[model samples]
Every structure is written in C-alpha cells, then in structure tokens.
Target: MILEIIIEEMSKIVSTIPYLVKYKKHRLTLDDLSTLANDSWLNDQVINMYGELIMESADSKVHFLNSFFHKQLMDKGYEGVKRWTKQVDLFSKRLLLVPVHLEVHWCLVTADFLKKTVILYDSQGIGLQKVARNIVKYLLKEAKEKKQSAFEMGWTVSSNEEIPQQTNENDCGVFILEYSRCLALSEPLHFLQKDTPKIRKRIYKELCDRTLHKKG
Candidate 1:
C-alpha cells in the first residue's frame, strides 16, 4: 500500500499541466511544477508563487519579496532595486518575507517590523550574518529614501540556529517554504526534516488549489 501511494503521488507530480497555478501576477508553468518532484531543486517561479499564497494567507500582513529581490539588492546595491518598492510601504507591513537564493541554495530572511528584527533562516545551519546585516542596511536606506527619516536602529539581525534543518542538499528549497509558511501564520516550527515529503505534497496541492492549507 505504501508503494502504491508513493507511485500515485509521483504520478500526480508528473501529470501536472502547464500553467497549473497563477498567483500574484506570476504564472507557474509545467517547469515550475516539476520542481516539486522527488529530490528536485525548486525554481524561482515556484518559490514566488508560494510566497503569494503565504501573503494571502497572512491576510496581506506579510509582504513577500520575490526570489530576485535579494539577488538584485546584493548585486547592485539598494539603488538597483529602489524601484521595486516604489509604491509599497514596507514599514507599514507587519512582516517582510525575503527569499534568498545563494547560487545553488535557498534560504529565507524575514524582517519583523514590530519586533525590530531581521532574521536569517537557513536549513544548512550556516550563520549568514552578512545577509542579515545587508537587509538591515537596506531597511535603513529604504527608510531614508522613502520616509525621509531613519529606520529604527539597533534591530536584532542574526541567524536562527534552533530551527529544524535539512539532512540533504535538495530539500533546502522545501525547508525554506515550510519555514516561511510557519512564520507567516504565526505558528510554531514544529515540523521536522522527515515531514518534507508530506510538506512537498501539501505545497503542490496548495498551488493547484490556489489556497494555503490551514492546519487546525
């Protein structure tokens, strides 16, 4: 029965047609859907699409930065991505979810305005203090440029070492998605690395249904 169930799920993952889900002006095609397959590294489109779901589920209180946001900010500095938030007031949001893609790995950085924190969530258990610092610096610059004032100083910027970690290379993307979901919903990070297979299916279904699954 277990083997049959696994096969069934794999079939579903393989059978998804192109443009299966479209959210937040981003269209998820077959290529993106396939990334959810067994052990496959997820692409930018899937991450961004799921981010849209997270924002919706958070009642729009969470502002999700696209997968490219960090890359642009780090590559060209804040000026390169200044227009990214032209009409949006990031400080007005309760949380900012920034998905960080470092070459081949995926991680998350969340800016909590209420708590005055910029945290890095990496499944590899690496301390990315520089990434956190850059985000904090960006927030300061953004405040000066948009609000004509300074952002709150002395914000806590550090990596979260206590969170669940991945045992394999390919699951980092999935781990990032789960971490983002838990944080956005204000839920405890009770999930484990073993739960990733189930989590991946949940994410795929959520994408197909255009809604985030709320656990009761």
Candidate 2:
C-alpha cells in the first residue's frame, strides 16, 4: 500500500517539478529541492536539466516509454509499417524513462497485466528510504486508476562484510520494493544508473520517516 501510494504521488510530483523549475527557478522551493542534493551525486544544474527533460516531453509517449523501459528501444525494422512500429517502440521507451529509472525489475504478462520490482543501492549515503517512500505514494495514487497492488516486502541495508570489498560496485543502504499488476511494467526492463532527483527525494523521505520512527 505504501509503495503504491508513493509511486502515484511521485509521478505527480515529478511531472510538476520540471515546469515549476523552468519558469520559477529562482522561486523554486528550497526544501523540495534540498531533498535532491545528496552528496555529490546530484546538483542543482543536474536537477534542473532532469526536470526540464520531464517537463518538455511530459505529454510525449516517447519520453514516457523510455522512462518505463529504462533502456532506449533500438530501431530495428524495415521501412513503412515496420518503421512505424519501431517509432512506436522509441516513443514507448521515452515515456517509460522515469518509471524504468526508478524500477530495477519490471515484467508484463499482457497488454494490461504487469509487475515491477525496484532496488535502490547506496541508499545510506544519500537517503534511499525517502525515495522508496515517495515511490510507494505514487503507486498508491495510481492504483485506483490502474487497479494495481503494491508491497514493500522487505529491505536490506548492506554493510561492507555483506558485500565483499572487491565486489566491483558499492552496495550500502540498499532497499527493495515489489509491485504487481502495473501497466508500466508490461515490457522488457533495463538497468540505468542515471540520477533521478524525483525518485531520490521520494526514497529519502521514506527512509527518513522509517529511521525517525525506529524504537531505538
């Protein structure tokens, strides 16, 4: 339920941030933007560009698909009808960009049946829990329209010993979320390491809440 809510809320939030930042860059809310500034991984300029991309192509299917797939669909079809299909795939890839960036795993059973899973690594350094929380919020909001279900399942914040030093990649403060019956996940999923402020903020908020509420 939390995951679903987060996903839905975040979609709305991210959709709006780009426009707000474009015309109201100077007047943009610091508190809202602060959530994006975690360590050196993300900055104001990066955030602005990120928001711009989302804003400029908000209605475009290409942007939407890219966000969902997490990988650009390669054009591989003959001219005419085949080319038209390829173009559709490209649009899908773009539209799915944000969703895919946030989601690490996604699968589709049919045109409308889908499932998605997400894994946030290096969460401790930045603030992944908040990001996860936001995603849940967004999902929850969308569930009503999409008739979907979401589950936080479990989270694992790994330490050095948990992941060998020579593991090639860092794995600290990692968290996972699983989703079912999602329309966005009805396609091949791909991995992207690009920075997504909207997702980062949502996960950060979730983590902060969990940490603050801990019994200690």
Candidate 3:
C-alpha cells in the first residue's frame, strides 16, 4: 500500500497538475514539486518556498532573504535591493539567510549578526568569497542608508567546507535547503549526501503541509 501511494503521487507529479501549494505570498506549482520528486535542480520558486518554511520554523530573531535578492544585488548593486527591507530591519535580525543560485548550482550564505560573521555553505564544496564580500558591503551601505551610520564593525568572511558535500550534481539544491534548515534551528550540519533522498521527501511533505516539521 505504501508503494502504491508513492507511485500514485509520482504519477500525479509527472502529470503536471498545475499549482500544488500556496504558502504566504509564494505559490508553488507542479513543476516545482516535480523537481523535488525527481531529484532535479531546484529553481527559485522551490528555494523561496522552502525558505519561507524555514523562516516560520526559526526563531523570531531570524530573517530570510527572498531567492531573488542575491541575484538582484549582484546585478544592480545595493540600489536594487535597498527597498527590500523598508518595513523590516535586517540589522536587527540575528541570522540572515541568503539563497544563491549561480545559474547552475545552489548555495547558501548566512549572515550571523551576533557573531559578526558571514559564512558560505556550498554543498559542492566550492567557496564563494565574493558573495560574502558583496553581502558585507551591502550591510555597510544598508546601515548608512537606514541607520545613518557606518557599520564599521569588522566581519569575518569564511566558507564552511566541513559540512556535507553533494556527491551528485542534482542534490545541491537539497543540500542548501538542508543547510538553511539546520542553521535556522541551530542544529549541526550533520546530514550526508546519502541523506538527500530522505531530506527531499521530507521537504516535499513539509511544503504540502505548509509547515516545516521539526527535527526529531
């Protein structure tokens, strides 16, 4: 019976049943869920949807940047995303999660305000020094524009290569989401490449339920 249920869901997923879930301001279509089911590269919608779930499950001090925020900043600089935080104060948040899509891969950049550190978590074990630098520069300009002062407090920019690395090309998205999920909950990044399939299913179920299941 469990196998039948799995096959049924997979059939519906491949049939492309239009939109499947709507959480907050984001709506995820069949295409998005299909990516998760087939172990394919996840797109902006899937990343942002899962990100919202992470924000909801995280502490009040946590903040999540929309998936597009990184690309906007990269393409147009601070001016592009300057108005993004008009209502919310990012500096006030303890952790800021930035999901980055580099056309071919997905990675996470987390800003730890309390620790004054910026770390890149890439599943493929690649480093993105420029991403951290640009984010630090954005924070400084944001402070000047919003807080009316220089954010001169030095920040350490580094990459965490010790985290689980993806062995397959398609699991990078799953890995980053797992990275963000673990960080949001203050859990250690201990999951492995072998765990991607299970993690992917859990994420899909969480998305369907419109709530992230806490790690047990």
Write model 1 residue lDDT over 64-144, tens digit each, in one string: 998999889988998999999887888888999998988889989999988889999999988777888889989988988
Residues 68-136 of candidate 3: C-alpha lDDT, one tens digit per residue: 898999899999999999988877787999888888988889999888799998888779789878888
Better of 1 and 3 by lDDT: 1
Preferred candidate (TM-score higher): 2 or 3: 3
Give the lowest summed-lDDT range of ten residues in model 3: 1-10
TM-scores of the candidates are: 0.89, 0.25, 0.90
Of 1 and 2, the candidate ahead on lDDT is 1
Steric clash pairs (candidate 3): none
Candidate 1 accuracy as TM-score: 0.89
Models sorted by TM-score, best on top: 3, 1, 2
Residue 168 error, candidate 2, Å = 18
Candidate 2 Cα misplacement greater than 4 A, ranges: 1-45, 51-115, 121-127, 146-216
lDDT scores of the candidates, listed in order: 0.85, 0.29, 0.82
Q: lDDT per residue, candidate 2, 29-56, as tens digits?
A: 4343343443323333333334333333
